[model samples]
Target: MRTKPVSDEKSQRKRFLSGNGFVPFILRRLLTSVLLVFGVTFISFSITQLVPGDPVAANLGQSAYSDPKIVAAFKVQFGLDKPVPVQYVKYVSKLLHGDLGISLSSKRPVLDDLKEYFPATLEIALVAVFLALVVGLLLGIISAVTRDRLPDQIIRVFSLTGVSMPAFWTALTAFYLFFFVLGWAPGTGRLAPGADPPPTVTGLYTVDSLIAGDFSTFKQAVAYLLLPAIVLAIYAIGVLTRFTRASMLEILGNDYVRAARAKGLPEITVIRRHVLRPALLSIITVAGVAFSSLLAGSVLVENVFSWPGLGQYAYRAAVGLDLPGIMGVSMVVATVYITMNLIVDILYRVIDPQMRDAS
Candidate 1:
C-alpha cells in the first residue's frame, strides 16, 4: 500500500481550511463558546455571592459599616439589594453592552481594571509560551531519540519535578534563589524603580519600547519578565516535553519515518519532514492549552512577583469580595480557555485530513 503524495496532503489541508466546512466549523465553535460564556457568567456571579465577606463592609470603614443608611445606599448603588438571579440578569445585560461593572474596592469599572493589567499578563504569558515551545520541543526530541538512556531518564525526572511542583512554591523558590541568593534576577514588577515606562502603543512595555526604539526600557522590561515568565512556563514546559516525547515516540515508529530512513535521507531530514510534521498536531493542541492555563491560573505567580496581571487583579477582587470584579475575571478566564480550545480545533481541521473528512 502506498501513501498519498506530499502534494495531495497539502491540497487536502488547503481545502480543509478554505473549503465550505470551515465556516460551519467556526460557527459551531463560536456558538458553543457563547453558550459556555453565558454559563460562566451565571456560575461566577453565584460563586461571588457566596464569598465569605460583605463587599460594602470591605469597601467602607468599620464606622460606616454600622451606618444603616450608608450601607443601604451602597447596596442600592451596586444593585446588591436585588436578588441573586435579578442581579445576574442585570449583570449579563450590562455585559452584553460592554459594561463589566464597577469594582467596589477600586471604585473603577472592572473592564478598566482588566484593561490596565491584562497587557502585563499577556506579555508574560506569550514569552513563557515561546520558551516552553522551544525548550520543551528540544528536550522532548532529545529524550525520544535517547529513549531509555541516561539522558532520557534525567529529562523524565526533570519533567516530573516541573509538573509536580506547585507553581507558587516554584515561584517563591525561584524568587529567593535568584533575587536574594544569586542576585542575578530583577525583583518584581514590569520595570526597575523610577524607570520611565515606554509610550503606551500596545500597553506591553517590551513591544512598546521596541516600537519607540527605546532599547533601555525594553531591556529592563525583559529582565523583570524573565524569571516570572520562566516560573510560569515550568509547568507548561514539563507537560509539553512529556507530550512531545510521547508523540515523537509514536510517530518515529511509523512506516513513513522508516521508509524515509531507508531511502538514505539524512537523519535530521527524516526526523523533520516525517516525524516532527505528524507530531505537530498534538504539540499545537497542548501548547494552546498550556498558554490558556498560564493566562487563567497565573494568580499565585503574579502575586509572588507583584506582576500586575489579570491574576493579581482577580486576587485583589476575591480578597475584597468585589463581586463584579470577581465575576469579570471569571468570565475573561472562562472565555479565554474556551477560545483556545476552539483555536486548537480549527488547527486540527487545517492540519489533519482525517478530522477534515469527518467534519
Candidate 2:
C-alpha cells in the first residue's frame, strides 16, 4: 500500500513538472538562474584577473607604490597576495554571504556602490526602452501599412541611420545641438543645478520626486533624462522598428488578415485586429532583450553625458583597474540579461496556448 502511494506521488510530481505547475516551474527556473549566476561569477573573476594592470599600484599611485610595506599590506588586504585559485575560492565564499568586497579605487563595498549606481541605470533604461517601444511600434505599423510608399521609404532611411550611428557620437551631437545651440534641453545629471533631490524612496529621481509631490524636481528630472534616454533609445528603436515591420508584414499576409480585408473591414481595423495582435509576442520578446542590452550597453552614453549610472561606474572601475568593481558590474549585468530572458520565457509560456500545453 505504501509503495503504491509512493509511485502515485512520483507520477503526480512528474505530471506537475511536465504540465507547468506554477511552483515547480518557478523552482526549476530559480535553480537554473542560480547555476547561471554561479557560472557568471567564475567567468567574471577569471576575466577580471586576466586584465593586465597592477590594481594595488593603480589605487596607491606613484608615491604610495614606492612603499613596500604599503603595497604588501594592500595586496594582502584584497587577496592579491594569494594564488589565483585561492583568490577565486575566497571570492566565491564571500559572494555566497553577499559580500562583493571593496572597490580598490573608491574604497567602498562593491555591492553598496552598485546599489547607488544601479538605480540611475534602471531609470534611464526604463525611460529609454519605453520611448523605443512606442516610437518603434508606431513607425513599424505605419511602415508596414504604407509599404512602398513615401512614408515607408522615409522610415526605412531613419531606421538605417539610427542603426548605423554610434551612441556616443549621437549623444555628443544631441548635447551640443540642444544644450548649446538651441538651448532646448538641460545639461547632464539627474537634476538641475542647485536643485535638492527628492526624498529617496525608489532611488530614482523622477519616481521619488513624483512620490514626494515635488513637481518642480520631477519636471527637471524628466528634462535631464530626455536627451540621454533619446540617445540610448536610438539603437533599440532601429532594431524594434525593423523587427516589428517584418513581423507585421508577415501577419498582414496571413489568410485571416486577407479574409478580414475581403470582408470589407476598415483598413485600420484589419491592421489592428488582425496584424498587430498576432505580432505582439515577437515584439515583446525583442523589447525585453533590448531593454537588457540598453542596461548593459549604456557605458559610452553615460560617460559622454556624465550620467552617474552603472556604466559610468564600470568605466571608472576599468580605468582604475578596480577588480572587485569590475567583477560586481559584470555579475549585475549578467544577472539582468538572465532575468530579462526568464521573464520573457515565462510570458511566452503564459501567453501561448501551444507552449503551455506542450510544457
Candidate 3:
C-alpha cells in the first residue's frame, strides 16, 4: 500500500514538472523579445540622429527660419538642443508608453498615422502570404517529385524569375501588362472609385465587407487586392519553393522514406506520410521569415496600386523627411520581424517531437 501511494505521488510530480516547463520557455521568449524591441528602437533613434541633416529645421520647414525666435523655439520644443543621450532616453521612455511622438512633416501623431494605414498593409500582406504558402508549397512538392521533368523545369524558371526581378520593376511591369494593356483589373486604388467604402469594423476592407453581407463590395475589394498580392507573392514563392525543394529532397533520402518503400507502402502514402511532414518543417521556417519581408516589400506594390497602406505612408514619409513617421514604421517592422521569428522558434518544438524532447 505504501509503495503504491509513493509511486502515484512521483508520477503526479513528474507530470506537473513537465507541464510547467513550457511556462518558463514562453516567458523567456517574451522577455527576450521585449529587450530586443528596445535595443532596435535605440539603434534606430541613434542612427537617425547621426545622419547628416537638421531634423528640427527640416521639421519646422524652411520658411520657419524667417523668424530667428521661431527657429530657436522649434529646436527647444523638439529637444534638439538636448544632449543626444538625453533625447534617446526621452524617446525610449515615450515609446514605452505608446507615444511615438509627432511626425515632423505631417505634424500628426505617429501612432495615429500608423493606426490609419497599418490595417490595409496587413490585409494585403496576409492575403499575399496565404497565396505564397499554398502555391509555393504545391509547386515545390510537384517539382521535387517530378524531378527533371517539364513541370520541374517550369517551376524552376518561375522561381528564378521571381528571385531575379526587382520589386519596383516587377510592380511596374505587372501594372503595365495587366492593368494598362490587358484591362482585366483596376489600374489603381483599393476599390472602384464610386464604390461605397464599407464600414470599418476590423479595419480590413474584405472582412468589413463580408460582415456587412455585401458580396458586391467584397468581390470588388478582393479584385483590387489581387494585383498587389500577386506581386508580393512573386518573391515569397521563389524563396519558399527553393526551401521546400531542398527540404523535400533531404527527406526523400532519409532512412524512414527508404524503409517505407521497402515495406511496399503505396507510393502516395509513403510520400505523404513519411516525406511531406518533415519537409514542411523547413518550409514553415522559411515562410515565417518570408512573412517579415512582405510588409516591407509592399512599399512599391502599394505605391503602384495606389493602395492606402503603411508602405505608401512610409514612402511619402521618407520623401518628405517625416522623422517620426519613419521611426514609427521602422519600429513596427522590427517588432513584426522579431515576433515572427519567436513564433517560428516556438513552432519548431510543436512541429518536431525531437525538438520538443531536446528542449
Candidate 4:
C-alpha cells in the first residue's frame, strides 16, 4: 500500500477525532456542569438567605446585633445591604474573581479556610475510599467464588448490617471503644496536643510531614486518621461488596468464562484476566459513587472525631448560622461532586468502547 502524505495524515486524523463527537460530548458536559454549578450556587445562596439572623449579626456577634450603625456598615462592607438579586449578582461576581467571601466566624476569607480544611478531608476520605475498595473487593471476590456457601452468607449479612447501621452510631461506638477505652488512636483532632502541623507543604499532614522528614507528626497524623477513615468507609464498603459480588457472579457464569475455565487455565489467571478485569466496569461505577459520598464529607464522623475537615467546618457554620460560610461550603461540595461526576463520565468512555460508539 502507498503511504499517505504527512499533511494528508494529519488532516485525516483531525477529521476522525472531530467526527466522533467525543470531544464535543465532553465540552457539552462541561457547559452543563457550569450551568449546574450556577444553579447550585443560586439555591445555596437563597437557602442561606432563608436562614434566620442577619449576616451582620453573624459577623459582629451578639454584642453588635442591635447596633444600627455597625450593622449598616457591616452590610455595606460585605454588600449585604443590597436587594437579594443584587446580593446574588455581587456574590457571583466575587466568586468569579476567586473570592468566597469572608467567614463570619473567623473573620478570614472563606476560600482561605476552605483551602486549609479541604485537604484534611481529602486525605482522610481518600484513605477511607482506598480501604473500602480493597476490603470490599476482597470480600466480594471470595463471596462470589464461594457462592451460596457460609462465606457468602456471612458477607451478605455483614454488608446488610453495615448498610443498615447509621454512621453516627457506629462512629460513637468505635470512638468510645478505640479512643476512650483502648486509647489506641489519638483522642481528638488531627494532631497531638502542642504539635504543630509540618510546614504545610501540601497541607496534608501525612504527606507534608513525610516530605519534611517529620516522621513523628506523620505517624500521629496516620493514627488520628485511621479511626475516622474506617468509620467513614463502612457504608461504602458494604455497597462496593454487594456490587462487586453481584457483578462477579454475573461474569462467572458467562459462556466465555465457562470456556476459559474448561480450557484448564489457572483459576487465578482466569479470574484476574477474564472475570475481574471485565467485571470492574460495574465496580468502577460503584466506586465513583462511593468516592463522591466520601468526598462529600462524613459529617457525623468528622464531628465526632473533631477532625477539622469540610464536614466539621460546615457543621460549625450551620450552628453559628454563618450564611457566607455555609454558602462557601455548599459551593465547594457542589464543585467537588460535579467534578467527580465529570471524571466518572469520562472514565465510562475509556472503559467501554460501546459507550464511546454510542456517544
Q: Name the top TM-score candidate.
A: 2
For candidate 4, the per-residue lDDT at 118 reads 88
All candidates' lDDT scores?
0.89, 0.88, 0.85, 0.86
TM-score (C-alpha, index-matched) for candidate 2? 0.93
Candidate 4 lDDT (Cα, whole model)? 0.86
Clashing pairs for model 1 are none
lDDT of 1 by residue, 1-359 (tens): 33455567778766555555778579767878899999888877777777677788888999999999999999999999999889988989999999999999899998989888889998898899899999999999999989999999999999999889999999999999999999999898989988899988888999999999999888999999999999999999999999999999999999889999999999899888889888989998888888888975589999999998999998888888888888888888888889889988898888888876762
The sequence of per-residue lDDT tens digits that candidate 3 reaches over residues 1-359 is 12234457778765545543566567778888999988888888877777787666566657877788898887777676788898788888898799999887777899988988998998989898999988898888888898889999999999888878888899999999998899987768888988897998888899999999999999999999999889988899898887788799899999999999999999899888899988878888889988898887899889888999999999988776666788899999999999998888887767788866663
Error of 3 at 13 (Å): 16
Cα deviation of 108, candidate 1, in Å: 0.3
| 140-189: candidate 4 lDDT, tens digit per residue | 99899889999999999998887777888989999999988998878888
Clashes of each: 0, 0, 0, 0
Candidate 2: tens digits of C-alpha lDDT, residues 1-359: 12234467778877656546567787788789989999999998888878888888789978889999989999998889999999999999999999999999989999999999999998999899889989999999999999989999999999989889888899899999999999998888888778898988888999999999999899999999998999999999998998899899999889999899899988999988778977878988998888888975699889888899999999999999999999999889999988988888787767667765663
lDDT (C-alpha) at residue 89 in model 1: 86
Q: Give the Cα error of residue 314 in candidate 1, in Å.
A: 0.8
Positional deviation of residue 15's Cα in model 3 after best superposition, in angstroms: 15
Which pairs of residues collide in candidate 2?
none
To one decimal, what is the Cα RMSD in angstroms of model 1 from the true structure? 6.0
TM-score of each: 0.90, 0.93, 0.91, 0.89
- Order by lDDT, highest first: 1, 2, 4, 3
- TM-score head-to-head 1 vs 3, winner: 3
